[model samples]
Every structure is written in C-alpha cells, then in structure tokens.
Target: MNSGILPAAVAGFSTGLSLIVAIGAQNAFVLRQGARRHAVLAVVGICAASDAVLIALGVAGLGAVVTAWPAALTVVGLAGGAFLTCYGVLAARRALRPAAAAGLTTQGTSAGSVRTAVLTCLALTWLNPHVYLDTVLLLGSVAADRGSLRWAFGLGAMLASLTWFTGLGYGARLLGGVLARPAAWRVLDSLVAATMLAMGIMLLARTF
Candidate 1:
C-alpha cells in the first residue's frame, strides 16, 4: 500500500465500522441467524458481498444517480417494510410459543429454511434504504474526498463489512449454550420481533 493509501484506508475502515456497528434490521437478522448456527456462512457472505457491490457502485458514482431518483427508494421501502412486518409477526408468534422457539435452536435450518433465510438476508441487505445511505452515498462521498486513493478507501470499507459480518455471524456461536435454553430463545425472538417491527414501521414512515 502507498503511504497515502494507508491513511485513506484507515479512514474508510473507521467510517464503515461506525456506520455498521449500530444494530439495525440487517444486524438483527444476522445475529439471529448466527445464534441459530445455520446458514451462517451464506448469510454473512451475502451481506459482505452486497456491501462490496454497493461500495463499488458508490465508487463508480452510482450514489449520485440514486440521489437523483428518490422514487427508487420509495418503491423498495414499501416492499421491504411489508416484508419485514410479516417476518416480525412470525417472530412474535414464535416468541409467544416457547416450544417453537426452542425447536428452532435444536434442529438445524432445513434446505427450504436455508433458502428462505438467504432470500430474507438479501431483502434485508438490498431493500433497506439505509444501506444505500450509509454504504453508497456516505462512504462514496468520503472516498471521493480521497481523490487518487478513493479505490483504496473503498477496499478498506469492503474489508470492514467482511470483518464485521464474519465476526458477528461466527462469534455468535459462542452463545449457543445460552441460546439453547427456551427462555433465552423466547427473549431473543422477542427482541428480534421488536427490532424488525420497529424497523419496518420506520421504513414505511420514511417513505410516507
């Protein structure tokens, strides 16, 4: 790495962490999947890869275009909000039933469930408007400021996404003993339900 690139990359890494560290709909989903210890690799890969793509697009100047068309976000917001709302309801139901929540931890997610999880992960990544705001516009603007080192900055940001998601997804397994308990699962599902519902409502409200 060039001398100048080091500083730019550090800035990008820091900025990316600051934006992504906060718990949101995406993080909540990732955390839940991690706790379940099923499809962890797939979910993390999708999120990291999606962020990389968005960062690349931002570096390519697509953020500027997205800004010009707020309507695009509006469309995505509607669909995402609705989907989140439904998912949240399902989670809420699981939380209410200790048996279902407990069963979730004991049995590995099936192939069908994995497919469902992958689709949900993709929706949570691509449909959430905040992703574009944080990864594309904000990161892109900061990278643009780096001039010649912007690509380096973008790479750093991509690394941040990979690092964070990998740690979050795999690290969560350490909690499997606790999550194995029914009460713990109920609490976790409850939190997940609340987070999802709140985010869904927030997304819908923003669109309006």
Candidate 2:
C-alpha cells in the first residue's frame, strides 16, 4: 500500500514471472494436459495454489532456514536436475515413438484426481533449489526490506505465479491438436531434451 513498497512488489512480481514463464518440464506437462483438455483448469489451480503457499512461506521468513543450509540446497539442485533429465528422456522417447492418428484422448474425466498433477507441481516448485533462491531468498529478502508492506510484495509475486500457470495451461490446451502431430512431437522432444541437458550442465557447473 505504501509508495515505498510498490517498487519491491513490482520487482518481486517480475522476478517470479520471469522464472516461471520458461518452458520447463512442469509447464510442458501442464500444456500437454491442457491441450488434451483433461483437467486443465484443475492442474493450473493446483500449480498456482502450491506456488502461493511456497511464496507465502518464503515471505514469512522461511528463507532464513534455506539460507543457513547451503549443503541442502546443493543436494536439492542435484536431485532436481536428475529428475528433470529423466523426465526429458522420457518425453523424447514419447516424441520419437510412431505417430498414432488417434492421439491422446481424455478417456477418464476425473478432474478431481489431483494427486499426480499436485505431486508433480509440488516437486517442481519446492524440491528445486533454484525456486528457493528465486522466490524464497531473493524475493523474500526484497519483500522483507519493505517492512509492513512485505505482504503486498508477497501477494504480487503470488499473483505472478497464478497468472503465468493459468495462461500456460489454458494456452497449451488451445494448441493440443497441432502439438499432437508426430513432427511437432519430435520437435518438442528435442527441445525438451536440450533444455534439460543444458539446465543439468549449468547446475553441475555451479558446483565447481
């Protein structure tokens, strides 16, 4: 609310948006599911909610714990990188598979079955040290400096996550038909593989 806090809130929102707007595994999954029109809204909702909780925790001073545990952060980075690499390999394999005209179908309309999406989103959000650095440490530090307006900064960051995820999920669903193409799948797989490998290499490089 205060004029002094406006800049911090805007900066936090921009930071959060930048980190999440990328074509990461989580976003790819959400997009694929959205394209399939299978529980797209629910998936987005889960992701947004999870991010809000994490960001809130960060703004509430949980960043201090993370700041004190550099070793833990390293472990999380390694694990997250490994997980992403594995996921990338799987996606590449799927893409390389023979194209079936039938494509993916929403055989089961179980929008309420939020277990898989929720768990995946949670890991993508909380298990990655980069997330802690971006949202918890960096954003939290800036928000903390706002004194009483820390809550406003946190809200802005939280809204950024919600907006990005919702747009990604819905936007991807709108393109499910085109992306279902065999050639499109191949291209997507290649991109995913490259992205994952690059991210892993970067993480490993940082350890040195």
* Best-matching candidate per lDDT: 1
lDDT of 2 by residue, 1-208 (tens): 4676777678778878977888766677677667666777777887888778878988898999988999998888887777776766766676667453235543466544556656666666665677778777777887788788788888888989998988887877666667656677566666766776666666666754
42-132, model 1: which lDDT tens digit per residue? 9999999999999999887778878998999899899889888888998899999998887887776789999989999999888888888
RMSD of each: 1.0, 3.0
- Scored by TM-score, the top model is 1
